[model samples]
Each structure stands twice: as C-alpha cells, then as structure tokens.
Target: MGLLAFKDAVHLVSRTGLGAEWDMIKQLEGRSQEDAVNWVLHSAASGLRPTPRMTPWLKLEPMRLNDMKTRNSAWSISQREGKLLQAWWVEQMLATHTPFIERMTLFWHNHFTSSIQKTLQPSLLYQQNLLLRRHATGNFAELLRAMARDPAMLVYLDGYQNTKSQPNENFARELLELFTIGRGQYRESDVKAAAKAFTGWGVDNNTGKFIIRPEEHASDSVTFLGKTGRFTGDDIIKILLEHPRTAERLTEKFWLEFVSNRPDPALVSVWAQQLRKSHYDIQRFMRTLLTSEPFWALQNRGTLVKSPVELVIGTLRTLPYPRESTQELLNLCRLLGQELFDPPNVKGWSGGEHWISTQTLLVRNAYLSKLSRGDLNDKSAAGVKLPNASEEQLVEWLLPVKPLQPLPTTPGARRLVRSLLLDPAFQVS
Candidate 1:
C-alpha cells in the first residue's frame, strides 16, 4: 500500500469531503492512512448537526385557490422560502466539521433527485433534504425505502398520481435508471411492473407524510425482475437491493464522485463486491474506499472538476466572511450553474467537466477575484493573513495540490490570493 504522505492526506481530504483548509490538512500530516480516514469519517458522523426547522412559509397548509391573486401570493411565498432554504444549506456546508457528511448528502441528493421546480413546495424539498442528511451514510436499502415514500420525491416523480386504475411509471423508471441499476439493466416490462407495485404510494398533503391508500393500491400479482408476486413498493426496493447490478451501479457512482471521472472497471468490481458483502453499509463502503490503494494513487489526485457548490462553499470555508453574505454566496452558486433544491432535471446536474463552461468559468473567476479582494457585498477575506506569506506558501495554503506551473508574479495579499484562486489547477479538486 502507498504511504499516506501529506499530499495523500490533502488529496483524501479534498476528495472525500468538500475542500479542506490548510490547517485541516496540516492536522492530518504524518498520520497513518487508516487512522486519518477513520478520524475524518468519525468526526463527520459525531459532529452531525440538525438542519434548521421549517419556517412559516414552508409549513403553510395545503389549500385550494380559486383566484389567480391568491395563487400568485402563494407562489411568491414559495419562491422566498426556496431561496432561504438554499442559503441555509450553504451556511451549513460552510460551518460543518464533517464535510464528507455534507458531501455524501449531496451525492445522495443527486442520486435520488427531487426538484422543487416541479414540487413547488419548499417545505417538501426541505423535508427531503433532512431525510437525505439523516440517512446520508446509513443503510442504502433503508434510504431507498424512505425515498420511495418521501413527499418531495412523490411529487417530483409523480408518485402521487400513481393509482390502481392508472399507474404512473415515472418513479419506478427513475428508481431503476438513475437511482439503482443503470440504464439497459432492466426491461420496460420491469418498469411497468414496478410501477404497478408502487401504486397508491403517495404523500398526505395535510400531514406532509407518506400515506398508503389501500383502496387505490394494486394488490394483484405483478411480475417484476423475473419475480412474480403481489409486490408492494417495499418489495420492489428489496428486489432492487438484492440485485448485483444495484451494488455495481452505486460503486460506479462513488468512483465517479470521489475517485475519478474515468472509472476503472477492475477497481469498481472490487468495491462492488465489498459493498454487497457489507449489505450496502455506506459508511463502511466509504471508509474502505478512502483507505484503499487505488484512492491513494498519485494520478487520481486533483483530477476532478470541482462542482459549483464545492467551489463556492469550499472557498468560503477557507476564508473569513460576514454572516450576512449567505445570500450573495447562494447567488454565486446559482450563477455558476448549481442551485440548491433546483437540479436541472431528473438526472440531476451532470457534474465533472460539465461544471465548467466558457460562461461559467468567467463567473467563477470573477467571483473568486471579488472574494479575494473582499469586494463581495458585506464580505471580506479576514482569515488567513495571505499578505504576510511568500507566494510559494500562499499557493500551498490556498490550493489543494501543488500547481504544475509557477504562479504569476503578483504583489499584495489580495492580488496573490486572486492569482491562486484563478489558477488552472484550482479549477479541479
């Protein structure tokens, strides 16, 4: 096994969680790989914080609106609540000790995607975010079960529309294609059967909880994935969990998110077997993957494009900022093509290289430049006295990995910080 050097520790921290500051990396220096991985994971688990409670706008009761004026008022309120929820999550990411918890929560969010754009209910989205955080690193099976019945998910995927007489296949199809087994692993017939199995699985609007309508449920036998029975939604989840492809797909997703964009089939196979053996224990799977030989490979270091949220939140966490700058930070993330609770589609944001575009790159550079100069509204870089440090030290402190080329000649702390932030290497994790 490769020794976990300072660089390896830095790489582990950057990839496993959101980016870490220099002090966080320094604290892990000289530690054994297993010990370091264990500490980061345990810290994240132990330091878990509860999400903020739902606000009044988010908790409004469902009501029938007969007039456009009342509906417009409700829409405006929902919009405000959505923005607040996004800012609140950004704040949590900035303050959390266990970044991996938030990072994994994000991964699961993308995996089991629910969009407020379709649901139009900020409270449902907030509730689903809490659900994702609660089971962020828990059992995959249980999480899948919870997701099947989540209020936001039901609304986003048309689960609420599914009934015995007319079953909707949106949730079931996504459950197979995007969530569990990848495309082409399951047949169209399987999707229909799974849809039938999930009939009457919906949310109770008044209570904001999952409620099964027995009268609307299809209790008739449905053959799915070669199993013929009166399978319910829970049964469908069990079958998917038992399938080998489910583990393989999840392992591939983990690799794509944390390891590399280009997955090695051999490495994925090794981890997939472990995941199956562990019965989809996410924490164990993540710990083992982080401490593995492949993860410590030098070539894999600094290879991923930082997603917008990671780029913004990671940068903010490294710098000092006014508490009131949360909205500005959220706006920056949105401008960079990532808005919390508003994934572009069912597939979610196609991260990696897709995070960068000609337009978005300019936005990223401008935001970083402003942030470095303390020009963002009500925000200033107060932490980490960069002016006192040499350029070499500044590079090390601000970036996750060493730059391939020498930094440009720059004077003043703010200028030097801007140069480092705009470095090509900083674009990647």
Candidate 2:
C-alpha cells in the first residue's frame, strides 16, 4: 500500500478538490490512501447536484432603431443571468462534500470551452455546465458526443451557422485541435471533412436545445482521418475517439491539471494506455492517479498554480465566512480573469504561470486581507471569535502547503491568517 501520510493526504485533497481544509484533512488523517481516494471519488458521484435553474432573459424581438430600449434591457438581463450562473456554481463548490466533481467539471469546462461572451445566452451556458457536471466523471467519449451537440457550443463555435452549402470550420477545427486531439496530429483536410460532417447541427433559439435540420446536412460522403464515409457529427466523434492520439492528448491534459503542468512522457504513456484500456472511464483513471506513487512524490507538491476559481472557492470554503458573500466572490474571480461561463477565448484560461502576475497577486492578497477583517459584507464572521492560536497553528490551519517565509509575529490571529494566505506557497495548490 502507498503511504497515506498526513502530508500525502494534504497533497491529495489539495490537488483533487480545491485545497485541503483543516477539518477535511482531519477526517482523512488515519485512513488508507485507497480509502481516501475512494471516499473522494464516491462522494463526487453521490453528491452530484443540479445547478440552480437560471432565470431566463427577456425575449425581445429583432432590434431596430425604435427597439433600442428593448435591446438594452435584454442585454442587461443577460449580464445579470450570467452573474447569477457564476455565483450559483461557486456556491455549489463551497457547499459540496465532494469537490472533485466541481474540480473536474472545471477541468472539462476549460477543456471543452464555450463562452457566453460570444454565445450571449446565459441559459444555454447553464445547460452546458449542467451537461458537463453530469458527465464529469463518466465516459469521455459520451461527454465529447454531448458537447458536439450542446447549444452553447453550437453558438460559441458557430456550429449553428454550418450548413450543407456553407460548412463553417470553427467547431470542426477546435474539435480536432483543441478538444480531442492535440495540434500537429491532424491535417487541414481533416478539419474541412469534419466540418462537412457536422453541417446542419444547430440550436433552437426559442427552446435553447440542439436541433438538426436534415435538409441542411451534407449527405455526400466526406473523407476524414484516413476514412471515407457519409459520416454525421456523431460518426466524426466516434472516429476521433478511435484515434490513439486522442487518448494521449486527454491523458496529457489530465496530468497537467491534476498532476503537474510539466509533462513526463513516460508517465503520460502509462496513464494514456490505462485511459484507452478503460475506454476513457474518468473514475477509474482518477482512482489510479490519486493512489499512484508519482502523484505523492515530494517534488510534485505545491507545484500547481491554483486557478482563480480554486483560489477563491477554496479560501471561502476553508475560512469562517458567510454564504451570502458569494456574489462578491464571483466578482472577485472575474477581476482575477476566470469568470465562469465567460472564458477569455476558445482556448480557455491558460493556467499555471499565466494565472499570476504582479497585479493579480496584489489583488489576491488584498482579497485575503478583506476576508480577515470581516469586511466581506456578511454576518457569519461578525460575532464569531477567531481562535487564539499561535503562528504555526494558524499556518497549518489555513494553508496545507508549506510556507515560503516564516509567519510574521502579528498580534491577532486574523492578521496572521491573512499573511499566510498571501504567502508565495499559498499561491500554488
């Protein structure tokens, strides 16, 4: 059995979920590594909950010079709905017993990225998020298939514009380049063929669901990836899954997200083989990964830079804070460059070193300071007294990772906690 030491448990929880809060660590303290890994995975499977329904935006007719007011009102409502969706997911992350699901949902969000910025439809975005959560730990092939037909994706990637006459290559190119296989594995011809395959796939604006117009579909056979057939979008997805490079690409991504940003070719090949053998079963892959020796290696600890979502949600969940401050937290995340449902680009947020800069780091530190001062516009910390703890205890409680500098000899526990949070080590997972 792999040693499930206290530090190892901390590392597991940190990488698997948001960050290892003290209470959660205590729960897993003496458990075997397998038990802990199973608990996290099973908890995610069982604790899965639907995202709260988004309030639909006002339906406005086609805009004209006279309909400027209506257009403005509709735009305002869309923004509000987007903010609500972002806050709702953040709340779920805070309250979830199984945070791995949320974390994986996040990973898939970045993986199969579709932004509300371009789609301009918050309701469809929420639906897509729900789809991701439902299949977060399920089969990768199934998720890819569903995403190809997702309304938000259709809008974001211009799949709705694709037809037999004019096949838009946006979704097709991303399907191969960004989603399934890595770049340089496929040719431009493959992209064109895939676009033809997905023609006539679109969303119904009135109902916000995927629709296929048979007349618009390209019925003619199209060659793709060394195969020629009258393949529809579904067939294209199946073919992509059959490619060995798809498994390798997904394995490398998972390693980067959960293991390390830096690639280890040999280790990646081992996991890639397992992923293919399991037919892209995420639960099995996660179990193997969390319990593996390389996962617990000393050099790997605190190596990942926490994304804005992880940093915000992890801090709120760990500290004594009110649930009502979720909106402010969401706004903070937006400033930190990770507004949910509005990824910066089709490629999504480039995590790791890209998540940090001098400006963002200062903002993070300031937010931690605000939390310490009980100034987050909430009552949870108003009357509650902070424990009269020493520097070491405070550091251990707040940050599971090792600190870069000694805890300052601050007078109050809250100040010390803030300082620890601002530490360089705390910036990493």
Candidate 3:
C-alpha cells in the first residue's frame, strides 16, 4: 500500500502491460498500489482499426466443399486473408493506447485456442478476435459461454459437425481439459456427456452465425460432474462454472501468466477461492493479483520468458527505433514460433522456456542486433534519441534483472542499451 518505487512500477507495467513503457511506469511510480492497479484496469482506449476485407464464410464455404480445384483456390485465398488479419492485429498492438487490452485479448485468444489455419476462415477469426476483446477483462463465465458458440471455434474444433447421432468430442474434450479443468479432473465419460450436451450446435452456412438444429439434438439425460440432467451446451457450461476446479484451473493459468512459470500451490488455492467468490469477475481477480505480495516479490522478477509478440511489440513501443513493416512483423512472429491466429496446436504456445530454444534465441538476438545497429554509432545516423539517463537508470529501464553478461566497459548511453538488449536477461520480463 506504500508508494511504488521506479523498479516496482516497471515490474508491474512490464509484466501486466506490453513492455517497460517509460511513461506508464513513471505515471505509476509514486502512486499507491491500489491507484496504479486501478489505472491499469480502467485506462484503455476504445478505438480499434477497421477489419481488413475478408471473403465471407457463406461464399468461401462452398468453394471449399465443392471440389479439389475449388478447395485449392479457397486455401490460397485463406492464406492471403489470414496474413492480412495478422497484420491488422499487429498494427493495432503497435498503435493502440490500450496495450493491456490487446495483451489480454492475446491471452484469451491463446486460452480459447482457435486458428485461422484449422478454421480456414479469416472472417470468422476476425469476429472471434472481437469477441475475445469484448470480454478480455470482463467475466470468465460470460466469455466461456460466448466461446462455446464462436463460429471459428466451432469450425476449428468440429463443433458444427457434432450431431446427435454422431457426437464429435474435440471441442467438448478441450472445454474440460484445457478451458475449464485440467486433464485429471474429468473422465472420458464426462467428455462424452459434454459432447452430447453440445450436439446440434452448428454455424449457419448462409450467415455464419451460431444455429441450434434442435432436431439433431439429443434429449436423453446425461450425467456430468456428478449431476444428472438432459443438458444443453449452456447447461454444460453452467455446470462447469459451478465446479470448484474450474476457478482453480483459471487461477493456476493466471499465476503462470502474471506471477511465474512455477505456481505456488498455497497461493493458487487462495487466489482461486477469491476468484470464485467474485463470481469470475476478471478485473476483480486481476486487482487482487496485481496487489498481491507475490506479484511484487524480488525473486519473481525476470522469471518469465517473453513471448514473440511481447518481444517484438514491446521493443518497438519502448524504444525509439523504427518499427518493422506489418508484413515483416508477421514474419518475425511466425519465425519466432508464434504466428498470430495460428497457434501450433490446441495447447497453444508453450511460452515459458519454450520461447527460448537455441534456434529462437538466435533469431531473437539477430533481430535485436539489427534493430540496434548504427543507432549506437558516433553521430547516430539513425537519429534515434534514447532517454537521457545515467547507466544505472538505463539498465533499470531496459532490463528486469542485472545484465547476465557484463556491461560494456565503454561509456555511451546507446552502447549501454545495446549491450542490455543482447543480454540473456532481456529475453525475460
């Protein structure tokens, strides 16, 4: 509850928002933790870039379903539009005043786990992106409910094909294992029951909206999580929300995301209880998390590996360097193992140490080295103006921990920053 020092403010902003954005950290530096956290929770701009034009699902669907040649053409169109969609989001992240919203939207996009590649419909994915943003920090229960019928997700997980006679368990299985509870909490039978509950939930071919084909729905009673009822998809979601593990699983994910890769079990329990008590209110949960003791712990600093989006977008936002073009940014994201709207699998990006394999580290270093080139030389031909700060202040601004590699023996501001940028520590928060 005391005023946050510069280091603490930097930690809060860097971990919660995009990067260690100087102005944001400075704004929160002398404020109470409550005030700073409130500012983060509420201070988001409402504007968004207009979505790029996409072939509507109605037109695109028939092309894919028609024949091999048409399907090949549809695939090519999907590839093109998907890149445009990726560029749209990349542009938003670079230009938005609401970086936290974009960050959380990315977070939920990972959790929900739909992909342009699997769905083959960039237009539907765009709509899914909008849905994720709307409920990014609003309510977990509502978001879960909305995601159940999300057109992209339906296509990605084959929920649209889940008829009463032939239940597809892909979406149901992920809903239990990844979304609601961890794997051990549910039985195979529970997945079957859940799939039955979701039967007849299909997207309309003409309009691409969620449509319930009641005739295809199973009306038989199915037991789920120790309860017996003839359940609908909404009914199944309601039951999952009431399960204790649902909140705990979500809390565990939050701990991994904001606290560290390794969650303290005792703290996870307490936060899970608090989240459940708040009726899954995400902003309230985040307020508790940001104000919690563990969030400010010294040992937790730099324990997280930065994702590709964080590294690319965060660097551009924090530094005075010119940004890569949107297309190149998309390529970096793909090369760095996190192509937007194209997560590797349902598990999404394995983010922790997985973000820093030997190959990716080389790419990361090469990108940073290229970005900082010439800007550090005498006369500074790139004309980038780094903050006028001392070596210690610059270190604090650029790194979450002491530079793993020794600082440069030479004495220049840009040189010091370039050294910190290449340090192993910069790959982390």
The best candidate by TM-score is 3
lDDT of 1 by residue, 105-162 (tens): 8998888887756776788888788889899888898898998989889988999989
Error of model 1, residue 189, in angstroms: 1.5
RMSD of 1: 3.3
Model 3 per-residue lDDT at 362: 94
TM-score for candidate 1, residues paired by index: 0.91
Predicted structure 3, TM vs. truth? 0.98
Candidate 3 residue runs with Cα over 4 Å from true position: 379-383
Q: Over the stretch 1-429, how does candidate 3's per-residue lDDT look in tens digits?
A: 599988889898999877888888889999999999999999956699987999999999999898899999999999999999999999899888878999899999999998888899999999999999999999999999999989999999999999999999999999999999878888999999999999999999899999999998999999998899999999999988888899998998888899988888888888888888888999999998988888888999999999999999999988888777889988998999999999999989888888888899999999999998774556464648777778898898889899999998978887888899999999998
lDDT of 2: 0.80
Residue ranges of candidate 2 with Cα displaced over 4 Å: 1-3, 44-73, 321-324, 374-397, 409-416
What Cα-based lDDT does every candidate model obtain? 0.79, 0.80, 0.91
Top-lDDT candidate index = 3
At residue 258, what lDDT does model 3 achieve? 92
Candidate 2: residue 86 Cα off by (Å): 1.5
The Cα error of candidate 3 at residue 40, in Å, is: 0.5
